[model samples]
Target: MKTTTYNIDRINHLIQQYQLGKEEFLTLLSEGLKHPLTWEAVFKEEIQINHLKRIDKIFKKGLSYYLDPTAPVTSKESSIFFRKEKFGTNLNLASKKIVSQFEDLKISLSGLAKLSDINLERKLPVFHSHDNPVSVANTVRELLMPRFKKDPKKFLNALIDTFAEYNILVFEYVEHPSLKEKTNIDGFFLQPNVIVLRRNQDYFKREIFTLAHELGHYLLNQEEIESMDYDQMAFGKISKVEAWCNHFAFAFLAGNELLNLDKLPNLTARNDYNFNEIKTISDHTHLSFSAILTYLVKKDKVSGAIYAKMRRNQEEEIQNRKEEEKKKRELEKEMGKASTASLAKPIQSPLFVSTIQSAFFDGVINEFELCKTLNLKPNQLEKYLR
Candidate 1:
């Protein structure tokens, strides 16, 4: 039966309350209606197609940074590495490790906190007092500036990547959240040190900026922030703390200098194509493909309508490709692990969420660090809780 308008609005209201993003909002919307999208759906849903593609591109670029910590920054395209999916552990199985580590981490933290008076100087900062992206960028740069003597670029990158190392450690490939989300986020600060992606998947350039933006929040020890839904933000009445986090994220990622529109005209003249000029400029600036495109439109390098059309077209194409692949993989079922493998019988796997939960319940781990390690929101993992 089709849902009534009232039900649909109710559903939307729930999503808004939970802070879901457009991608996540659409996903939850479909799932809540009892029509979970499949690969076929991707082809049908142009927006999702574009989103997944953008995410995959960022994953690839981010992977490059992971593969060679010391590799030259320009080696982004070349230095990236990947294992054949055929050889990688199924994601369902991989998630168990996070559960296990959560317990291990809890114990470590508890030991330190009880034995010593460890005072956390938890003060979060944003651009001194402005909304400039560059201001926040400079703030983060300044925060990490003292560490410049220690591999400057990597530290700069780390300012944006909170959990890059954890991602490298727990899973061989990027992890799609093991659990379903009821909300959208600007992005989730999944692991304490890592920000699971939110946007910047398509143009391939905005990946760094978005990641850096999320890093701004995590750097200051925030848990969850609203997504790019400005409508909600306008009437939503977020706390001052949340606003500060947003300011930090914007500033840290795009840098005030990069976002200044006045300077963009000059930039366009300097290069045959300015911010919107694809190909070399994105790579040269270490910006994502989308960031440059959007900036171009903002600078009047492209019309808003044209930009919107391009975005839609790009999103549609990517969704189509993903849907096609999803179909191929579904057909390859016998040769591949089933998505249901995530619910693999408790005794079947080598990894153990059982052990992790037990340890936490037994007081072997501290709550904060345990939750951090599990990549879980405080009370989200029902099975892992006592």
Candidate 2:
């Protein structure tokens, strides 16, 4: 077998770029290559073609990249890892990897768009933390809001479609259930207009809220990688930019109904926390009950104790629902029915889809490149091509 010798300098540069420690990279290589190869054997010695191919798969850059001696070190300034000191939350390895994955996709999309002569520039006004969130939300709501739908999925899709019309790219990612390290982050907005969402299969409403929150960041022209927690809006100390985004998301989702929130009588022991009114608003707005309650808490209509108790109950209910769902899935599997969750694909932005299609049709990228860029298999390309 003709062995391939990977440039040690290129391998070292990629490891550093990914922030992978030497031992950690070696362990990954060991698992991926399926051989207990020592550091010296990989860097100082020639590796088999199969091993080199596995290394390329792990790095995700083409095999040619690792073979090139002249490949320059990737600039940290272009990466979120080095550019942002804070991301509104601590990013774990999975979170960082997910972000890096999308960042690379964004770069690919930009190049494709340029080649295809498709404009991906954001068509929205930028605002500041000092801007009035409610006013800003009202203005943006008019432009982005879709006809309300009670179903969370329909509403989310509609919002995403509206976003595409405005040239705001929304990409969703799904983590397989078997993955050991899962991302804790909900969503993030990248500058020059890209928003990435984590698919919340259990609670589509959370994904809806995440989309709105990331949109808030986009409008501010500020890049933020964040985990969306409504409780933080009520209790945790947050930056003004974060607060502005939260309020913006609320007002954007609630629309004219926000005016009525101020009018609702404050929650008290005698009022039963105005359950009926809150439920009605949640149904009409498609915002989660907890989200509405959190806003009420911010308005001082709901006491912290009341908010905490309600949140606890809601969480318990969600947990019970999850348990029920698990049993139901097990039952379905036993009965030989396909599980819908496993079949679900991450939502793709129409703008992104069109860009890739154009790139392929224009001879900018080949069929294999299209499938790779779209994360589809060759057989699955036909559905997307249409």
What overall lDDT goes with each candidate model?
0.40, 0.84
Worst 10 residues of 2 by lDDT: 73-82
TM-score of 2: 0.87
Residue 22 C-alpha lDDT in model 2 = 79
Going through the candidates in the order shown, the clash numbers are 32, 0
Candidate number with greatest lDDT: 2
Residue pairs with backbone overlap in model 2: none
Count clashing pairs, candidate 2: 0
For residues 1-386, could you state the per-residue lDDT of candidate 2 as single tens digits?
A: 56866687877766765677878777777884456778777555676777687677666678887778686646654676655667787767678778878887887789889999999887887899999999999899889999998788888989999999999999998888888879889999887788999998878888898899999999998899988878888899999989988899989988878877779999987988898888888888877888898899888898899899999999999999989988999999999998676447888888988999999999999999889878898889989877
Off by over 4 Å in 1: 1-116, 123-128, 131-133, 142-181, 188-211, 214-224, 229-251, 254-276, 284-286, 334-386
Q: Could you tell me every candidate's TM-score relative to the true structure?
A: 0.41, 0.87
- Position 5, candidate 2: lDDT: 65
Poorest lDDT segment (10 consecutive residues) of candidate 1: 78-87
